[model samples]
Target chain A: LEGCAPCGELAQRLAFLAEVDRLKSVLRASLLCDGSRRENSAEHSWHLALYALVMAPHARPAVEIGRVIRMLLIHDLVEIDTGDVPIHAQNGAAHHGTAQLQAEAEAAERIFGLLPAPQGVELRALWAEFEANETPDAVFAKSLDRAQPVMQNIASGGGTWAEYRVTYAQLVERVGLRIERGAPTLWHWLSESAQVYFTARTGG
Target chain B: LEGCAPCGELAQRLAFLAEVDRLKSVLRASLLCDGSRRENSAEHSWHLALYALVMAPHARPAVEIGRVIRMLLIHDLVEIDTGDVPIHAQNGAAHHGTAQLQAEAEAAERIFGLLPAPQGVELRALWAEFEANETPDAVFAKSLDRAQPVMQNIASGGGTWAEYRVTYAQLVERVGLRIERGAPTLWHWLSESAQVYFTARTGG
Candidate 1:
């Protein structure tokens, strides 16, 4: 029971949890496949974790699914502070440029800092790895993070693509290359669907 | 490149992903602590997974944090089929009787079955372990599944407790005991807050 004493560590953990609840309110540009409403960052993270778990076999060099899952779950917590920057919106990457990257790094510090030291450092590392997309696990995680919204857009009949008037070339250049790096199989399957989607849109 | 051929395995995996996207639409009994609206099962699953990550250190016997995270992520996928049955609601457990168990098992089968064989079997086994709540990992996972809503309720100044007219006695018996078994420290701290919350309401 002495160990169970009300402690600052517990309070810090709860504070972090409470702050992240804001993520459920931070909407992404992607729509639900059902076309219900825009998906939020929290559930999108959850879905991407699911993607990692199910799609681990598709990773070229293989990856530790657990590490990939960890990356997916916490990678977007920075969005709670910096808000979502959709990569497809006109100049969305431009918008997620140097200033946004700095803000996201600071947000990661403040948000993960809400936890006790060990846990905060571990999660901060995972976030940084996901951003780097250098390791096999991080690359696979980045693939899922990109793949999910593409699936949603295709399923919802050109969801954000339609709304943003994105072209096939932009979709391939901006999103397809990243997915190809980590998950060529997924990108291959999705590119076929994308080609059909855009071709139909142009009545080609 | 041969492995990147659009194959049946890819289709099956995508089907599973598309089907589970419905999970985001299924709402839960607990409101977001912000009181903006009810949280959906998908986001709740996401949040609980986040909880397992941050609170893994608190589990009494300690548990595999990765296994706990997977359990939390997929535990409520059954709710996509059966919908959420809030425990504090009158007859809630009664509603979760044999028939409901059967329905949930079937839901797990159909949903996880949408993935290729190895992945589906792996995920379905995880879901069953979560339901059994017998393993240390499952017990800690159950602790988080319970702790999250109680935290949400307390944070929102009795979010679900007020909504369901839950009494302290019922809270202690129904929720507190479960959390105590795996996360006694969390229960100790939360019970103190619950005491003050209920005491203030009763003017005791």
Candidate 2:
């Protein structure tokens, strides 16, 4: 068992495969608002990760695009444990503030544990860094994660936020965390757009 | 807008991606029960669809493997609305089976609604067939979906089931529906296995 790095890697890989199989059990996890055309979480990751690649150029220069990509890719994994807390319900008074965070922390431990010692440690560390939001990369990552949803919700007629009556100002303020901590330019755009968004009638 | 097939196809594509994202999310979903190695839902769907393809020779002769693959691909979308109703918690009293079913129905409608137009309708229909368990293809899809978890839970020392005291007999009996309703041969193996499982660990 000492330095069973290769064995750990094999085990982790096998374990990953098993989880992958299980995940297929529930692909297009739909919300309560719209019916039938619900998107699966898997699609969400791929699409967002791609978005990170495509939109990186438009991102604030100082922020690390790679880190933001990573953050967006894995941000929603916690939903697996906590279930996809609908966008509409995110700001509810349920006080689940850190509950999802805690759940993801635990899940990350289990998932990353399967990898070989070195890879597991590294991956887990990356996840933790993103979670901590202390580093510039983490800040950038968090901002992008929020940004993707903003675009998506808007495209879908403000998807869940509209359903939930979330004001544009509130969303910008909420998402402004990225700028306050890291990307000021992106924040500026978001802030201005949010004012307009709030001022406009509920079009969707 | 009425019989738009493209809408269903677009929804189908989105569902595929979303499911994978869900798996990645699940890998880090639960702290208490999740294993160390995480698997993205996308990986899960790809693998299961592959499973359906590889195991096609093993399925009942008459069942439509293509339809089964579709079922396996999208079965888990409901988790987005209901969250992953862990196997342990599924049988509990609060589920209010009827309400849960209704809620899932509504959520499915919303999630799938994002697709273009015609594509959405087809995907919705496929999802419905899987849920209803009326067709031969759906039966096998349902069967494979149910069967994948059993082996994993067993290998992982019964995983969440052990924590929840899920009975061997109950799982076996559950498979009977698949056999009688889905693939007869698939059920044949499950039915036999259930007897042994029940005998070894009798009376939960």
Candidate 3:
């Protein structure tokens, strides 16, 4: 709208690029389930983006890989304003769940709106699709994000394990859900790896 | 050029957004000379963006704030492949500098070129302008990015000081270069701050 009709797209492009860059500054995630040892928002997004690429072959019934890629990329932008809340820690958080989710939902809308209308709508839809987890592609993308780090943790002798003292049961529940939801093979391997490592551990 | 003229600037806009998103992931700075903690690329850019905004009044004469802002925003994209080579690390080990700078220059061209030709050209110009540090806008942008974090670290009790083992002497030299190049007033205050802090300890 700020530029000539022909230049409108260029204007929108510049504005959208600026918006996502701004969003990156706001996105943060904790390596631990607790608020400590947090990684910057950009690192989290990068991890997800890489998940989309490497894990693409493992998606469900198969869909547009590009669309699924888009879904994974925007899925976590909402963490910007709501600041990253550790989902696992919310088990007994009382009323914090609804408020936190609502804050994320609102932040998603505002950050997406930073783009011009059309792009804003497209990205918002991708984000929503990923959150709903009903679509095959979204399910796969979400599972990968949840599962890859679990794989890393197991590989690293339980990443964030010593820091947070994550238990076998708790870790299983967190990592096992992915197998049931998407990428059965990755989930299967992850479950087995966790089993072998958890049992072999000596005195904590 | 990938998109036909009729298709317009859509390709460029999408490309630019995608490129900036990737840059954020690649960035990792020690966040001070002392290497206290890592700062996300996005946060670094945000701080620099803020620097451009607040320091406009003190920018070199005839510098365009908009150009400077754009340059500072994307200046670090080159870091995607190069990673954040700290200033202190560069002091005596300048032998490998050309390859890294060349790689970044190419990365900038490829990333910014994703947009429409004109937009790509505009962005590349801005990126190179900041790197050259010859123009007033480039000099001012570079100076601001360097100077702000030094005082910020000092105020924060050498956030990076103890971590990275940065000395006041190094900060003075780095901060002083900015003053000599673009922002004399800011540099002067910082130099004086270093002197005061050092003298108090010296029993002067």
Candidate 4:
């Protein structure tokens, strides 16, 4: 609307694209696997979408890769309004869930509504499916969403885990269960490797 | 292999994900619409993927949205090794083509090979399909790729165009033809809107 009138699909798409650039500024608790800095929500969504593509063949029940990827890509648009809440935060997660959900519902409407018709509805639905994490696609997407940060934390030498003072028990219960449910094999491999890092820190 | 052993699909996927984080460091000529800094290839790919989802309906021949999204996401990845070569560079475009191609081919192998089997092959092929720009999906992906920079350049007040000393005729031929071929409606609107900016600077 600033650059030009929203005349049609292209205009609407451009406006949405411009608006979503705000996502780059929204930071998260997870560090980059490289230890460079904290990963923003936009980069997290991008990485998870790429992970969906790479891990699609391994998904149990053979989920729809396209749907999974779309869900992953759009899932965090709500965070644009609500801001990122680290799931591992012991005290924060309890109070944040309902408020975050309420805020995100409004956020979804405002953000996805930036697009033209059909796309707005379609993307809103994709975002909702990802939130529900009900379908096979959403489940696999959620698994990658959960798995990536664990990998990042481990790669960065107990990154967010150390920052949040996370214990192995908390991680296994909070993050590992969803991952195991959605991607058992990855959970198997990841949990074994992650325990090595967690155990070393806890013992030391 | 560096941080952890590449023992299985999960390990391989995690390793490959870490390696591709290097894509974030690979910068391109185009500035963000915000004029903060140049966009990285990873961010560029992510934006184009989002655009593929948003613009799928407008593609003239009706491309496979999944494939188009995949192509767009993987296309610039070869640049992680070869470095971004601006498509519209005044002098460099003519001389750099062959060398850039050879370098990108090697980069594609090294980067995509980091993934697990079948996935490595599949992604490599997707990257190639995007490079060739022969299929409907690839064509549309390329159009979006080309169109994005134009929008950036225009939005940033003749950004790369002013810096590189690009002209109206050069832009029409170099960037517009492919955009027109892939999405004529967008091309029509873009060209008309863009001409105002170019003409203002060109005094035509």
Would you list the C-alpha lDDT of every candidate in the order shown? 0.87, 0.54, 0.59, 0.82
Let me know the TM-score candidate 3 reaches against the reference structure: 0.50
Candidates 2 and 3 compared by TM-score, better number: 3
DockQ of each: 0.61, 0.07, 0.05, 0.58
Q: Give the per-residue lDDT digits (tens) of candidate 1, residues A7-124.
A: 7898888888888999999999999998989999999999999998888778766589998998999989998888898887754465458888999999999999888898899899
DockQ, model 4, C-alpha based: 0.58
- Poorest lDDT segment (10 consecutive residues) of candidate 2 chain B: B24-33
Cα lDDT, model 3, residue B188: 64
Off by over 4 Å in 4: A3-6, A90-95, B1-6, B90-96
TM-score of chain A of each: 0.94, 0.73, 0.79, 0.94
Better candidate by lDDT, 1 or 2: 1
Question: Lowest lDDT 10-mer window, candidate 4 chain A?
Answer: A88-97
Give the alpha carbon lDDT tens digit for every residue of B159-192 in model 3.
4444555566766665567655787766765576
Interface Cα RMSD per model, in Å?
2.8, 9.9, 12.6, 1.5
- The local lDDT score (0 to 100) that residue A163 gets in candidate 1 is 86
User: Which residue pairs does candidate 3 place in steric collision?
Assistant: A27-A41, B12-B115, B34-B160, B34-B164
Candidates in descending lDDT order: 1, 4, 3, 2
In order, the B-chain TM-scores come to: 0.94, 0.72, 0.81, 0.94
> Which numbered prediction scores highest in TM-score against the true structure?
1
Candidate 3: residue B144 Cα off by (Å):
22
